[model samples]
Target chain A: MRRHERHEMTEEARQELAAVDAAISGEAANGEHAPLQELVRALRGVRPQPSGEFLAALDARAARGFRRAGQEHARDSSRGGTARAGVARGATQKPRRRALLALPALGLAVAVVLLAILLPGTGGPGPQPRATNAPSKAVFGAAQAGPAVAPDRAALQPAPAPTAGPSAPGEQARQVERTSTLDVGVAPGNVQATAQRVFTLVNAFSGYVRQSNVNSGPSGQGGATFDVRLPSSNLAAAIASLSHLGHVRSENDTTNDVTEQVSSLQRSVGDQRAQRASLLRQLSQANDPQRAAALKAELNAVEARISQREGQLRALRTRVDYTRLALAVTPEVTAGASTGDLTPSAAAHDAGKILSAALAVLVIAAAAVLPIAAVAIAGWSAVSLTRRRLREQALDAS
Target chain B: MTLVAPRQLATPQQRLERLYAESREDLYAYLASLLGDRTLAEDVTALAFERAFRRRRLFNPRRGSERAWLFGIARNAALDELRRRGRSAALAGDLAAEESSREDHLEGVLRRTMVQVALGVLSARERELIALKFHAELSNPEIARVLGVSESNAGTMLHRAITKLRKACDAQA
Candidate 1:
């Protein structure tokens, strides 16, 4: 019977435990497990409390930790503040540095532009204007003036004569003497043939070869040079024909007027003739032998003067009517010449030409690049300044 | 009952002081229950407050109440202590022994002792849930947030833990 009673109590405990579980699981209210609820309430009431000393110690430790943390925070903020100040200073100075760098570059650019605008007007071997109607100061020989009178006085003071007729329209035309030099490249072994062709062409144009030379190089490559004078009217045709002899590597042409010189020489000739006529009249009327001899001597002197002046006039007229041409014929070898053909002197000459050309290019390049380099430097400085300022601004804001 | 003020208007230090004053006792109690030692619980409580003070700048009141946050820290401190003591193994041994030594009769004080022993029989996770629910007195959703689980999951786990505790208690009885 006692065993049955114990069993009944065990059943009651299990029922209460089930009710507690149900309440804790939210399936039932705490009011449904009043006995178990009461037990939980009592257990909670017995929950331990910390001692006063423990609470005090805990608060002290916490305060110490807080103090340390505050110090760290202060250190961090101070470092950040220093960094911010540095950024601010940099930002302020950046533009000034950029301006400093850019000022000289801008100045250089402006100077270069000014130079480019002003340089072309300064210097070169340009053609000079011809002086028309000027007397020729060039005296050919002492024979051109009588011995009895000073050469300068005689030439300066001409016998009083009727004013000369108005110059013919053709004579008044500006006389321009044209001359040219050409370098022609011909096939190897064809230099002589090309030179002969040039001679034939000159004769056809009523031109004369003033000087001619032909040579064969060690490699059997031949070359020829010619100084020729062509009628001025046929100059263009002569050059065209010479170009066909082979390939003209280079050509230069120039013109000069000698009309005033020609006219002056003609006047000198006329003066000499008048003086000779005066001496002849004196010779025919003279009675004393010594006077006749003196008059004859004056007449002879006047005639010699006339001849010299005539020669000068003829030479001037020849120069005015014909154009001089200098031509060089070089054999064009398709294959390399033998080493013997490349003389040290020839190589040095070539090297000198190349060096001079390179120097000229360098000078021209320097002139062209100076302003561009200045502008580029300025642009680079501006870009870098902008980037630095932006970076500094970001740092300051942070 | 001290009310949680709007922390947005308060400075970090003021917010921390207020959080301490309001939740210190409850947090201490929860740590004591979770760790099962008053001295260790006090140490953990101080450590938790220090950590909270250091990280005060990171606190957002919109996330949760100060109590939930403090308890979460306390839970981690308690677990760290438990690990340092190597008590997890001992707890597991005690749980196994209790499982094998089931009894069905007890009442009053013996019942309370049985309940306490039964709490020891629970797994660390079950114990943590029980502590957060009963000792920390956090609501199911607050417990979920602290434990990083869903509210329903937290509730379900709590219910299972309570059932196990009741069974252990009943078996001890």
Candidate 2:
């Protein structure tokens, strides 16, 4: 209260309280409030004696020294809730306080943790994942039991020399188009040699390279990428053989079921062949020139369609029979690597970029969590106040 | 309201024991009056002491005296019981019963009956105020602290309650 408000008692209130002492004490208040004094005396006499049984039970409990039963939250948490009690209750509320503080803090911590988890995801393409000095083994480890999981194949990952398709015994023949990516890091001066070894491995697995790009840097420092297609049955083994040439930095596998497309193309090809055979038999027996010409033209059109459909079917079959692999070979970063990009300044630049990214993530996390934490704290405080008010209002109610 | 040693000098257990020794009767009387049930008042009174003992370290003598603090706890416990029962404070069957028929005169019995009936005329809040003022014998400032009200507001409420009690008594007469 302000200085004046604390001392701003009115004369009427002063007189109203003048006999309060004498009246409550049941003494005569000089004939001014004699009636009030009598009532006070009567009220004082209204006290009823507690039964001896209850007193004995109470004395027994008190003798036992009151063991804690943890029913204290209702009474202990809000002890001395006034401002003056803050310093006093702080000591008493210590153990119970961690519970109150942790609730809101836990909410904020979850938000920041969620933001941190999403920091590296989906924001205009942050820097590509770099291959650092440390070698990592990150196979998705959640897929297994060997059912040629297309979508979940990236989950536990294929073992070395894995047979990762419906080609397994007792499985239905599921025509699938499979594509995989593997990034291998080789020691300096071995990129070109590694690229050659990859081609050799593909050939051993009866696969062919459709495209190859190798950048040969000075001092045997370079990188290579190849789009190779291997026989479907040998895909997993071929990758396993090729990965032995270098350190596998990253790997991904994907599959698409093309069973319906293959089936449709097969039906189209069969229909075209049947029609062409009928036209050939009719052309051999035709006698009229004009009619023959018409028949021949129709036959040619059907023949062309047959060839086109056959070509389409062949391509579809080829795709289903072979899995495409994109392999990238990069020089492993090392202390003795002969790349100019491995200089201290470049390392510092990379570190700076990474630091900047981490800071951005932290700032974004803070910005996201601050408002929520504010609302939570405000809500918690308001709820506590309302609950206390309601508990007090219980007296006014039933 | 007893003058005691420095709070810091004594352990919380010692202080609470002293508070119990000094104030148990008044505490029970105040609760029995507010709750209007001998058994319930006894239960809540014991509950108040147990609660007080469990939270002994929380008592800050700087805020108010030990009696006021104990009364505050007792009041809250009684109020909670009252709220749970979802009824007004009905005078106990034994509360207004005449005690010691041999020593009790007819005039005293009638006076006690009239006072008890007049008490039934007040609201639960008014009854609690009267209990605090008369049975607990708390000063207005101490009562204000226990009730979470300003000193003047407590004084005004007490004055109004007392005035109503007098009017109720006259009507009963």
Top-DockQ candidate index: 2
Candidate 2 lDDT score relative to the true structure: 0.67
Top candidate (lDDT): 2
In TM-score terms, candidate 2 sits at: 0.63
Give the per-residue lDDT digits (tens) of candidate 2, residues B1-173: 23356555367777887777677788888887776666667666777887789888998879988888889888776766666565456653357763424236677566667787887788777877888877878888888888877887777777777778778889978
TM-score to true structure, per model: 0.34, 0.63
> Fraction of true contacts kept, per model?
0.10, 0.41
Query: How would you encode candidate 2's per-residue C-alpha lDDT over A1-398 as one tens digit per residue?
Result: 11112334567657756676777655578676666666666665666666677567666667665544223323444542332132223224545866887887887888788877776632322223333211112211101111122222232232333345647655456788888999876655667766666665576567899999998786446899999998887776666656655556678989888888878888887898888888888889989998889989998998898888888878877887888899998877541212223577546654665687778877898798879878887988998677556656666663
Query: Model 1: per-residue lDDT, tens digit, B131-168?
Result: 66665567766786776556556666666776687678
lDDT (tens digit, per residue) of candidate 1 on A1-398? 00111112244444654565454444644565664564354345434455678677556655564444323333444433543233234224545977987886776667655654455422221111122211112111221121222224332222221122112245446666667898876556566656666675677567889999988664445799999997776666556556655545677988677768877888888888888888888888899999999888888888888888898877777776777899998876531111123556645644665576555544654777776787777888998566544432332222
**Interface RMSD, all models, one decimal each?**
19.6, 8.0
TM (chain A) per model: 0.43, 0.52
Scanning candidate 1 chain A in windows of ten residues, the lowest lDDT window is A134-143
Provide the global lDDT of candidate 1 against the true structure.
Answer: 0.58
